[model samples]
Structures are given as structure tokens and as C-alpha cells.
Target chain A: MGMHLRACFALAVALGAANSAIAETRLDTDALQLEVLAGSCANCHGTDGRMVGAVPALAGRSAEQLEARLLAFKHEENTGATIMDRIAKGYTDEELATLADYFSHLPATAELTP
Target chain B: MSQPWNRLSRRQLLKGLGGASALPLLGAMPSLAIGGQHAGHVVVVGGGFGGATAAKYLKRANPAIKVTLVEPAEVFYTCPFSNLFLGGLRDMRSIAHNYDELRQRYGVDVIHALAEDIDADAHKVRLSTGDTLRYDRLVLSPGVDMRWDALDGYDEAAAEKAPHAWKAGHQTTLLKQQLEAMEDGGTFIIVAPDNPYRCPPGPYERAGMVAHYFKEHKPNSKVLILDAKDNFSKQGLFTAGWQRLYGDRIEWVGLSNDGRVTRVDADNLEVETEFGTRHRADVLNVIPPQKAGWIADRAGVTDSSGWVPVKPDTFESQQVSDIYVVGDATVAAPMPKSGFCANAQAKVVAAAIASSLEQQPAPTAYWANTCYSLVGPNYGISVAGVYRVTDGAIAEVPGAGGVSPADAPDTVRALEAEYAVGWYNAICQDTWGTQV
Candidate 1:
């Protein structure tokens, strides 16, 4: 099973590179490594992954919604959000999945406004 | 319309450079090659306020760009609130920041290494460990380097005895130690540096904080500021606060009154004035003249004035086009060299780099700053401004911001203190990840 898993991982890498041709030209895997996100979203978003107004609650965002928003910026669909778009364009699909998983599992943070 | 954002006047650029070397306004274009991580790598030198801010923002703005921040030290002791430590309001630990949060929170590649050399032509940074890191865009925000010879008989060696505590950290602790070991009635004199220095109101605030200590613990002790310049930021308010809080207990001498320190005798604890007056103080906090960090000079970014010249709107180095110099290291005309200025400049640079990289329309760049100085415990004052890049230089937008109301009502000053701390936290969030 271990040997088979290793072979599958190797094949995944090979296939991932082969599939790069069909991927969007702007979709760079390295720049968008969501695993590198430390604590930047905590200010506007609650530490527990809840978000303030307009920031959108990251607590239960669907993986598709997350990927779509990120891809929207990478493809230049959203030009209004400069910083977010630029940051989103740097993530790889695998890392994006990790972020989507992490945020989706966290409980929603409560809003501070009275 | 295709011209780079805005061209600064030659006079303004010269004034910005302050007579260093003549550098091209805009030189070579960056390769625009695909960086290893999709976005180009941003190599940041220094881990203090400015460098840390830039590194954090670069990652936050676009995580695709691999950000490698290099600093020699393990921890950063901020100069902003160090004065409070000297006055016994806070401890050294309270003011220190470790990059652990920055690394864990921002996913920044933190290299605990001193930037010994730079191969700018090759776009490679050679770390002290003999490791080489390449960058597509380098952000040099190494803060200020002290010009020791500016004061006769005072060099790095003399600094051991008469500590500057200007850069904070160990020096701050050393100065605090000296203050602690001082005789109750000992004279504490702070020699203020010339213009183009960090935290213009810092020395005055230090004087106020130290005087606060003297008033409470050692009523006979006094503090004096021997300044090089005639005017200072928030001068009227600082002086008024000093008069009300520690009148006659603190003496502030400026250039107009011959406060310029000519020389110092470290062994004798004596400082000679321009007017031939000699002062012998038990404790001397000599904040010397400063220049852009040595890394800027080594990288050939600095001109004659020992500061890097850059296009204000883009924050790109004039000498080396692909590289941008921000923070206190850059000669940001009409902008005081402060942490707030550095944070604002980091945002502008981040946006411009993103725009340039994506071939998108550049956004109109603006900057904001709010410098707060604590006059005493819970007694604080502030000056806030919103800046706009005009004619290639950052100029304060008229009537956009103002200083904390003069001799501010107690309620206002107290609120300013609260806002000041909040502003620090908010700006820190803008610069670093909000983990802490």
C-alpha cells in the first residue's frame, strides 16, 4: 500500500505538470500557496474565522465559492479589489483547498457592533 | 498618458537625494520574468519596524511573492514605546517583538541572517551564512544607520558609555540601566540629532518621560535636551506640556540658543556646546546624526546625502529601477521618517508593483501618518496627516489632518493616548498579520 501510494503521488506530480498546459496562464501554483497564510485575515475577520461586514464570513464558505473568488481575481474578473486579487492570484489549487478546508471548519466569529 | 505615474522635478529629486551621487531618474526595467512562486520574490532586509512592515505587507498584499525577510537579530525592540520603559511605565519585554508571529501568521520566510553583501547587478543577496537568495523585486527598508563621527570624540566605542538607544533593543536596555544606576539627583542630558532623523519628537518625549520619573522618585533630578535644530514637530505643545508638567525641571536648548553640541568627553562625562558652554552630566543619551542603512549604501542605492532616491509614487529606486527603497532609508521629501510613513509607503509600493506586474491601471496612491508622543503617563499628543503624491513628491493634502489640539483639554489628550495605542495596533495589523 505504501509503495502504491508513493507511485500514485509521483504520478500526481507528473500529471499535474502535464495538466498545466490546460490551466489558465495566470494560474500560478506557487504564488497562491494558501498554506503560507499566517494570521493576516484575523484583523477584519474574527480570530475564530468569522468576518466583519463586506469581508464575508470565511467560517463556512464553500470550497467552490472560495476557489471561484480566488480564481476571479487571478483571471482579472475582479479589478476593484487590488490587494486581494493580487494575493489570490498567487495560490496553487492544492493550497487553496487547504485554506477552504481550514476556514470552513472553524466556528463563525461573533460581530462586535452593538 | 503612458509616462510613469508622475515625474518629480529635478530640484525636488536633488533635494531628496541631498547631494549624494547623481542617479538616473528611472533606469533599467525589471526582467518581469515569472518568479519561482508565480509572483516575483520580494527580498526585504532588516526586521525592525520598517522592514517588518514591508515584508508583512508584501506577503499580505500578494502571497504569491515569496517574501524572505533578513535580519541579524532575533527580536525587535521598538523605539516608539521604549521611552515608557525608561520612565518605569513598561518593561523591556513589553516593547520587544519577535518575528514568530510574523512568520507563523504571514507565512513569511524569515531568515535570521545579517545581509552582509548584495550583488545588485545579479539581483542576488548574499547572506552572512554564505547562502544566496535571489529576488525579482527587493525592498530595502533597513531603517537608519548612525553617523558616529558627526559628534567629535563620539563614535561607536563612545556609544557604549553614552548610549544612543536610538535603534532600541540592547541599546535601549543599556540606557535604561544607566538611568537606573544613576544618582537620584544626577543630570540626564539628551543630545538631539540634526534633521532627517528618526522620530523627530522622540528626544523631547524621552525627556518628558525621564522627567516624569525624576519628579516622582527623585524630585531633585533634572533632564535637558540639547537640540541641533531650532524647530521641532509638536514643539509648541511639547514645550507647553513640559512647562506645565516639569517646568524648570527640564531644560531644552535649541540651535538658536547655541544648543548645538560641538564635542563630548565620554570619560569625563562632559559635553561642549557651540557657545563654549560645557555641561557635565551623569547620564548622556546622545542621539547622533543618521543616514540610510548601510545596506542601501552597499547596494549602491544611496546618493551623496546617504539616502536612496526613488520615484515617490512608485517607491522604486531611481538608481536601480527594479528595486524599491522605502521607510526611513528613502529620502521621502515633505514626509517625516517615521514608522507610519514607512507603512503607508509599503502600501503604495505593493499596489504599484502589483499594477506593474499585472499590466493593470495603477491606482491613485495616497499616504497617511499619525505620530503620537506620550508627554507623561496617560498624557499623550499626536499629529495626523493624509498625503498625496504631487509632482513626483509626497505632499500633505491641505487641511486633511491636524495636530492634537494645542494644550489639548485633558479629556482630549487622554483620548489621544488611547487612539495612539489603537493606531499602533491598527497600523501593526496593516503591516503584520493580526495574530497577537
Candidate 2:
């Protein structure tokens, strides 16, 4: 999965390789895992990570972008981060990757409950 | 459209249970949900953060699950942001929420009534309207009810003079009016209860907000907090913020300092502390000790400590089968009884129950919470934590989350304040689909 994500990220914002990578990851992860995992981000980021203002909405962001940013925050690579750094470090690299992939597919304004 | 409720048919009308089952929205149980169990009825009592969220998320997790929310209020005035209202930063309407979205958007049946009793043996709940609901699962987010007479000389009648304002809504408005009517230089006393109460950081945050109000309007008025605990949540940050922002306008008294208020003379605006020290106040806000809301007691879920003990992974009540409890009512220590924690716990229970109905293994269970307190309008401080079940209880992940650094600049504080509003908006949206 790391190699897959790295290769997908190397494609950089292009949906092709990243889509395939996440598509494979989705097969083994049950809906319960994905939905419950993503639900956590809803408190601050809005349901499906689609927070409308001040906080950037996570929906539709490329998986690479989301994963890369989450890693940077977790590792303290982003000095300007306030809360995300602390929150990101709580999850393993794999869990963060799952979250990034989870929010990457939703629309920017997905319904709170669908 | 306005709908009428009839006792002849009772499916659901309570918010307490939302903390137990609000996730999954899979269209239909994939024929694997325990062999013909097609997402049975979930009755939720209490429509606050935990219950409303559970109801909404249960539907989200499985659209086939019949979810009914029971809460007595048409509009739930949030206790979370009501402090800001106390500080004059917000209005009552901004903190008000309703069941409109939970009903129309999520297809949940929202019933406005007080849940009276729980027949655990029969899996039924008796409501104030003389109606009853039967459910395959029950979620109780019933919040807290004051332990009347726990504090000497403080009871329902006394609350009229020294308003607890702890439950929000009417008491919140009442306290604000008292603040407004007080003399500019008068002392406002806040009596904070002992530990294991709802919102560990709440009393301190209340002091901060009331001080803010006095700083702007009264200028010379002062706030004095009398606490039962020697230390409080975000103590250092709160103390530092108070000193830097309000500067002597607010003072806190700890247990060692004889800060425990033992008896109250509400009519005379007086209280006696431990060591027989009496103090007078122009405005008295007494937040008394509490227990799980009565329904939890009626449901036979609460322990002698007045809080419901729950399973680490699923928040299911230890005392009752098929009944789950979340929010202030549950013994979820390390996870403070904040709205954010309740909302987080609500989602996990929703997933756990949804998966159970689907005959699947439990879902990935981890929770994160961030609590932002504004010492002043542009002076915000926060504490965040990520938690997981460890040794059969919720424990904070080490090295992952903590209080904001002591050396943050005003610019960062301002940003955090904005983020506070964003958090409120997003979380409110997540729970009841209400925003301001």
C-alpha cells in the first residue's frame, strides 16, 4: 500500500494512478471501517470533510494531496499547523491514508446524512 | 408540514438513544445482517449532541434502520456555546437547534416528549404522553440531571436565586439577565461542583466568559470561582489567559484555598465555604453536582455513582442488555463529558450497532476530540485528544494531543477563535443539521 500510494502520489494530482490505488484499498476495507473512520473528521472538518469556511473542506481533494498533507502535519513538517498536527499524529500512517482516501471521493458539499 | 402524534402507534420519539446507533446508511442489510435482520427499529432518547447524532448516523449507516428520536424540547439550546452568550458574544437563537433536519433530511421520526420509563425486560420506553416505543436497540444520551440537595441549601427552589444555568436554555438566559442587572462593581460568584461532572473545563470557561462580559460592560465588576477540585481542565492555559486578558478582573479559589462552597443562602446572595467563610455576591451562578438524567436511572443503567458504565469499544451499558449510553451520563473518563466527545462516541456506537445488525465484525473504533475555549473575543485556547480503547477503557493516545503552547501570539489566538466558530458550525451541522 505504501509503494502503491507513493507511486500514485508520484502521478501528482492526476486521478489515474491514485484512483487505482484507492480502488484496490477499498476492496479489503469494509464499509463499516471506511464510514466510521471518515465520520471522525466530521466534527471539525464538516461531514465528509466538506467544511464550508475558514477550515478548508476535504471533499474532492486528491488523495495524494490529502495524504501528503496529513503526513506532513503528523511529522511536524508543517510548522504553521495548529490542531491538525496533534490530531494527525494520533492515527497510524495507514489510518491517515485510509482517511485521505475516504474523503477524496465525496463532493465538496455532500449531505450531512445520506 | 405539521404532524400529529397519536398514542395508538408508537415507533419512536426520544433523543436519549441517538448516542447508541447513528451511523451506517447502507441501503439494505446485505442479506448477511444476521440472517433476515434488516436493520431493526432503534429508539433514541434525548436529542442533544449524542442522541441526535446517533439517530442521524444510524440512518446514514443503514437507510433501512428505523430510527426514532425522543426529546422533550422542540429546540435544544446547546450548553456548549451558551457560555459565549453569557459573555455577550452570541444570542440565544444562535445556540438554538431543532429536529427539522433530523426529521426531513435523515428520515428519522423525531418525537417531542419526555421519556418517563424504560422497560428493559420488554424493550419498551414509556413517554410522558402515555405512549410506548418498542425497539431492538435503545440509545440513551439523556445528558445529566442535578442531584438535588447534594449541596446543602441548594435545590430547585434555591436555583431560582442562584441559577445553575448549567442545563442551558432558561437558566442561561436568567443568569445573563442577572449579570446585566448587577452593579458595575459587584462581585459575581460561580460555585463549581466536584469532579465527574459534565464538562470539566466548563466552569472555568464560564468564569472566562463572564469576566469578558464584565470587562466590557461593568469594567469594575469581578468574577470569583469557588471550586471543589484543586485543579481543573486546561487550568494553566485558563489561568494564563485570565491574567493576560482580564488582569485581576477574574480570580479562582481552589479546594486547598477553602474554595469549596458548602452551603448557600440564595435569597441573600450569600454562600458559606468549607472553614466557615461566607461571601456575598450580586449575581450567583451555582453549578450543582449531577447524575445521569433520570431516564438512565429508570432504565436501570446508572451505577450508584450516578453515571452509566459502558463497554469500552461500543459504549453499551454494563447494567442493561441492548441499551447503550453516551454523553455526560456515562462513565467515559479521560474522555471529558463535552459535546464533541459525545458526538464522537455516538458515531462509534452507531457503527457498532449497524455492524451488529449486519452480522459484521465491529467497525474501526477510534475517537478524536478538540475543545476550544475563548478566554476573550480574540483570545482562544484549546485542548485536543485522540482516544482508543485500552485495557477495557478509553485512554488518550500518548504524545498526540495536548493544550496549546503557552507562547502563542495574538494572531494565532485570533485564528483559533475563528476555528472555534468553525468547529461549532461544523459540529452542529454534523449532529442536528443546524448551523449559525
Candidate 3:
């Protein structure tokens, strides 16, 4: 029984090691974080930044333009009445740049339309 | 100025944690991707914020995956901005959304039918229409159900007399009517439920809205709040706002001060508290304690707390395989049961499902929630948070999000109120694909 338990433990460790190796090779952490940061904008900006109302859509803009706008909000220079100014302040400059790049690459039009 | 992107590398940060590799572990599993096809059928129950967003994203994530959304209601009334309607700042049609866009625009098979039973083992769902449908993966966003027995003498029958108005539609209209029918100098009582209820700031916001209505229509009327908890979400901001806007019109009694309602007499419109103090009011709004919806309980996914336990990364039920639970039905701690939270969780689960179906490494999951509440027509406040899955649990990232600043300028408050309306339109558009 002890030998059987040891064999099971060994198999689990082996599987864990194999998974770690695969993840290190396959997962792109940079792309994942950028997606996470950009996805947060969807709460008020519409999904993938295709906003329909007064709130401006963030998709399909130049990365430089998006980065400049976010930086302005973050620095409280172009402060808005809403929470965007405060929300922008929460992210680092690097994170803002990543979000800009990510949203800039998404299709400007709604992707879900038939 | 753009800062360099590699300030804090997620890979280097997660390197020490060997468990970070669980993403690929999920990839190695046998694809539930069935029938010799690259795509699989994903059935979503409950077409609220969670289910609707999931269905849309599932199709977007993998055009091959067939998505079916089962919802009993044709038009959905959101609880987020319904308080504004009650306050007379907006109309009912503004908060209502239909499934036309989600159906025609997203190619989702939107079925307006009741989901009766879930056969987890067979991956089949039995609908009220006497038809059974199969799914490779099932998503349940059943929201919440009021515990009728939680408050003595307060049940569905009594709720008809004094509406809870927690669920949006008829109950909301009923509460609005009651407020309108109230006499000039009447007393309005709001009974808030215990911890872990839907939308923590909801009852307080309702109080604000009612007070606003009274101030405009019946200046002599007063609003009383009997709370089950001493401290509430955004308490400082709410109390401060109440003092400024409604003055003495709104009064709050906490649990510590014998404020918890023990029983109710709907006929007399009287509520008896823990100290046996019976207070009679012209109108009473009782929000009872809640649990996972009836379907979740029937599916045997709920634990003792009456909420489904799920893996933080994927929102897959810990009790049942291939079955994911989202929204207020799941035990997503540190994350309040709010519409925004539900939408955020749906995106994470959709991405995970897509990666699994497509035989790719699952992306690391992160979620964010922001809830905006209007104290009055021109007064607004909000709370926001960013969360990540760590050590098999959801944890709020430090210094990521916070409540609206206390004692802000009137201009800031007014701007938040306008943004609140904009947020409602944006979220509705995102969820239902409707142009609000």
C-alpha cells in the first residue's frame, strides 16, 4: 500500500513538471496582461470598445492617440466629471500603454454583428 | 509619454509559483470538443448580464461554437438603473432591453423558455417545453432567489401587498405606485437584508431615490432604513450624501441598535424588530435574505450557504464537471453580487471555455467590477475594484480601485450622475447588443 501511494505521488509530480514546461513554452504572459487591462475598459466603453452612446469608443484608434488620451486622464489635465480620471490614475504608465496597444488592434466595428 | 512595457513582468513574477502552469494542464485534458467537429455546443441558462455576455463572447471567441441562451423573459429590466426610474430621473423604457440583437446580430439561439432541470452527468438540460437539449459545456447565471422563510410573516403573498421590488419589472412598478399613492405625511420604511445580498448598495440607493421622490412630491414624508448590518458598502459616502441631500428626511437604524426586523404584519404595515418595537409605516419595502436561484438548488450545485462553489479561474462548478456557474449564484467572494461583476466573470469564463475547446493554453484570468449609485438626480457615487485569481481564490488587487472621494465638489458629483446614465447605456449595449 505504501509503494502504491508513492507511485501515485510520483506520477502527480511528473505531470506537474510536464505542465509547467508546456506553459512556459506556450503561454504569452505579456499578451494576456494586455488583454486583461484592455478588457477592463469594456465595462463602460462597450465590449471591445465599440461604445454606442456619448462615451467614446476606444477601438481602432492609433496607439499613440489612445496612449496620449489615457495619459491626459491619468495626469488629471483633461479631467472628466466621471470616474475615468480616478480610474486612469490606478494604472501605471506602462499598463496604460499596453491597454492602448491592445484596444488599437481590435476591430473598430462591432464584431458580433451577423 | 509611454513607459517601457516590462516594468513588472507577469512571467517573472509568476515563475516562483509552480501552480501558474495550471493553464497548460487544462489544455492537456481531453477536448469536450465533440462529434468529430472542431466546435461544440455551449448552452447558457438565464439571459441576464452574465448569460447574455457569455453567449455573445462564446460566439465571438470561437465562431464554430454553437451558443444557445435560455431565458424565460423576452425583455430584461436591469436592476442597475431602475432606482433612477423610481426617482423619476429616467423612464422604464430606458432600463429595458430586448434580445433581438443578441439573437439576430450574434447568431445566438435565444430560447425564451424555462430551464426546468439540468442532467449534469448526461450533459442535457430539460426545458419546460418538454424538450431536452444537450451541451458540451453548460453555463448557469441564475442570479438569486429570495428566501421567503428568512423573514417571519413575510412571504411572496405578503410581498404582493408590500413589494420587495428587488427583481426589476412588475415589483419595481408596484413600489413606484405605492410611493405615488402614499399620503403627504406618510412614513416609508425600508427593511434591508443580511450580508451577501444582491447589490450591497442597492437598498441604500433605493432609500435615496425614495427620499428624492418624497422631497419633490410629498415634502413632509420621511424615509426610515432598518438595516441588518451595522456597516454597509459605501456607508460613509451614503450617509454623507443623505445628510447633504435629504437632511433629516432619511433615518437609518443599524442592527446593533435593535434595527433588525424580526417579524412583519403586512396587513397593518408594521414591522417588529429584535427589541419588540413595532413600527407602522404607510409603505414597507422588505428585501429578504437570498440564495442561489431555484435551478441551481435543483441541479445540486449549491452548498450549505445556498451558493454554488466554483473555481476562481474558470468559474466551473467545484461540484459538477463541465458545468460553470456565474453571477450571483456562485460564491465569488470579495466580489459583490452586482451586474458589472457578473459581466466581468462571464468574459473570463468565456475565454477559458474557448481556449479549452480550441486546444490552446488557457489565459490567466482577471476581473473588474464597478458599481455606480445615484444619491439624487445630480448626486452620484461609485466603487470599483480589480481582482485576480490567486491560490484558488479571488483576491482584490491592492491599490487598484476604490470608492468615490468623500466630500467632492458638486461638479464632480453631477458628472458622476451623468456618467451613471452613460454607464447604463454602455453596459446594456455590451450585454444585449442593443443600441440604447
Q: Pick the candidate with the highest TM-score.
A: 2
Q: After superposition, how far is residue B275 of candidate 3 from its true place, in Å?
A: 1.4
lDDT of 3 by residue, B327-379 (tens): 99889989999998888888878777777765665566767788899999899
| lDDT (10s digit) by residue, model 3, range A66-101 | 988888877755465356665666666776776776
Question: What is candidate 3's TM-score against the reference?
Answer: 0.85
- DockQ per model, Cα: 0.02, 0.34, 0.18
Q: Which candidate should be chosen as best, given DockQ against the real structure?
A: 2
Model 2: per-residue lDDT, tens digit, B1-436? 0111211011121111222223332322232223433458899999999999999888776655778899999999999889999999999999988889888867789999999999999999999999999999999999999988788899999998899999989999999999999989999999999998988888988999999998888999999999888999889989999999899998899999999998999989999998999999999999989999989989999888888999989998898989989898999888889999999999999888877765666665788889998888888889999998888778998989998888889888888888888888889888987652
- Is model 3 an incorrect, acceptable, medium or high docking prediction? incorrect
- Model 1 agreement with the true structure over B292-337: per-residue lDDT tens digits: 9898988889999988898877788899867888888888867788
- List fnat, each candidate: 0.00, 0.56, 0.29
Off by over 4 Å in 3: A1-37, A52-54, A68-82, A85-93, A107-114, B1-38
- The docking quality of candidate 3, as DockQ, is 0.18
Q: Report the C-alpha lDDT of model 1 over A5-97, residue by residue, as the tens digit.
A: 334334434544564331222222222222113133433343334544434457667757765665665566535432344334434445345
lDDT at B78, model 3: 91
